[model samples]
Target: MIDVAELRIGTSGWRYPPWRGDFYPRGLVQRRELEYLSSRMNSAEINGSFYSLQRPERYRAWVEQTPDDFVFAVKGGRFITHLKQLRDVETPLANFFASGVLALGRKLGPILWQLPPRLAFDAERVEAFFKLLPRTSHAAAELAKRHDDKLKAEPHTDPSPRRKLRHAVEVRHPSFAEPESLDLFRKHGIALVVADTAGKFPYIDEMTSEEFAYVRLHGDEELYVSGYSDKALEKWARKIKGWGRDTYVYFDNDVKVEAPKNAIALAELLA
Candidate 1:
């Protein structure tokens, strides 16, 4: 585990009701959850963006609430991946960029795009979507300027003051396992997500980018409801150590309030 690159461990989302008493202190207000969790964990994924667009104020508040070292991985909207199937999504992509995501500022980590199970591998379509993504924060903010009226108020199209705009794609279909998909990632410098879905989805741990790696742990023994056992955590710690690259690991198994506990445990193991 020595000489390995920086490792970040955290949960997918912080606003789960089930975690109130276990992960979060009892009687803690909902608004303070991120503040409390960020003190213990180093990073997390903003799951809300996957469902709908969020305002810049929220992103600013998130950045203000967390510590300086805390980073957030923003989930790309499903409109681009599922509904539109990555076709003619230029506006949607622009809207996403304009939707105050850059407000995360230096706290922003990577943007994650998770595809549905039904969508199979289409190199042309995938490549098009990948090419549309902006590599640097300045480029993303520049693209955000083309956002439509959906944003309503002033958008956070400011240039990124921190790292480059990194993107990670997670495909559930088996077809993406093909080698060609890997090529597309290399060409675009996109990281292939290493998702552990308890066999419910496709698993691709391949590192297509040298910049960083992303891993989503949906569950171990069960989907969403189960927690990682000691042996399971050890296995993952060893594997993560072998990566030797900046890695962000997010636990998606929050159904039973295990995501936070498991994430903290894994973080300790890596530490």
Candidate 2:
């Protein structure tokens, strides 16, 4: 069995400006934000990687700054999920794999692939994408080797292959609520994101993987602005404990700068 200690609770990102006054100290410098934030949470979702590729030095610096046990759940780029729509994305996938993510090595947790609201469930397309995913860092390195010329220069091409690579898929379409979707996820060893999107997206609470689980708490009442109430945190704690699986929960309700506070509250409840 996989180590259950991999379970973690954290917020999506730490670079939000609003969090400086509320979660971060008033006089803290911007450069030291990650270090301070890591001390408070065992894990954090790297949302910036979703928008663009990250450099090796950045990953190395993050590793040096955070505690030895800290892990980052890197978000997959939208170029594959949003723009390319997961089709004909071999090169894009290669670019992502080559984008210094492996530098996180053991500090890396799950890679989150969030599909847009417009993309509905298609078993063929989904299966194709899943097959392309690398099951291990070694595999990712092999995939990265095929990266186009754009990333050839100064690419962090080394493979760590520390442990098995895990992935979680977050879908917004209502069509994904079906049993077939769950079956597909289970077949590919991918976790279905248990998301709370203020009733805006389809909320599916099934455990597709016994090895691990992934959850994104967008908000309790409002999508990105509202905080999870104490009662809500307590309920989530109970459910999470009941799962008895290595779980990763990231609070995405950061518009009001309540994500870190709510995430800490939930972690405390579990404690």
Candidate 3:
């Protein structure tokens, strides 16, 4: 298993609409936020490409700004997976992999393939898509439940197909939180992405699971409509203490002021 203790936690630190009011002056906000976050966590998941194409020079600038250990987990563009089937598309998966995006070298983390609710688990499609991926790059698949029975089954064990690839599975449905699901992840060496949502969701109980933890803190659900709260930060800090492995905690609720503060608080706890 990968050393989970080395994993850093933070939110999807990309400039978005909801944060425009608080994080005005996009360029400055991005630079400062990156600096602040780099001081605490070593990794972040980037969702910028989901909205637009990324410039290599801009990515190089980011690489130059952050520390050597800083890592970036990029979200695959919706055009390739969500909008168009893996079969035919304007932007091929091979092209995206070859793009300077993944060329960030060791600083590049896993490629997140967040599938839509409409994308059910089809063995054929899944097999074909996996074939197109680079063997060395890590991939995390977030599947929204459309087919229940197939989703419950274990990942196919065809060793002849790409063997060295690593995968993390994130399922929104409650059924995925079962012992079977956890066992499946352990058996297949798939990391479970623990999501903190508006309602009761099964986040991995740190005491029980030895697998790497991928946590997403979406601020306080009560204050989500307004923004994040300091109280919520304290609660998450306490919870993270129990995690034994490297944990990735991301703040999706508030990316502006709240994310920096919450990240500081969590880092203090981890320290």
Off by over 4 Å in 3: 1-4, 14-33, 36-41, 85-91, 120-169, 174-188, 200-211, 222-235
Candidate 2: tens digits of C-alpha lDDT, residues 1-271: 2236667999998899998877999999999999998999899999988998877788888899899999999999999999998999999999998878898988989999999999999999999999999988888988988888666346777887457899999999998989998899999889999999999998999999878999999999999999988899888887888788899999999999989999888887777
Candidate 1 has which clashing residue pairs, if any? Answer: none
Q: What is candidate 2's local distance difference test score?
A: 0.90
Per TM-score, what order, best first? 1, 2, 3
Tens digits of per-residue lDDT for model 1, 68-176: 9899999999998999999998899899989989998888899999999999999999999988999888889888999998874687888848457889999899998
Using TM-score, give the best candidate's number. 1
Per-residue CA lDDT of candidate 3, range 1-271, in tens?
Answer: 2324565766677545554445444445545656655666677777776555565566666777779889877777677766785555323554354334544656766566655545544545545565555544343111211112221222221222222333444445555456655665565455566666666444454222354566766656632332345666667666666565656677666634565456556766566
TM-score of each: 0.97, 0.97, 0.66
| C-alpha lDDT score of every prediction, in listed order | 0.90, 0.90, 0.55
Q: What's the lDDT for residue 74 in model 2?
A: 95
Models sorted by lDDT, best on top: 1, 2, 3
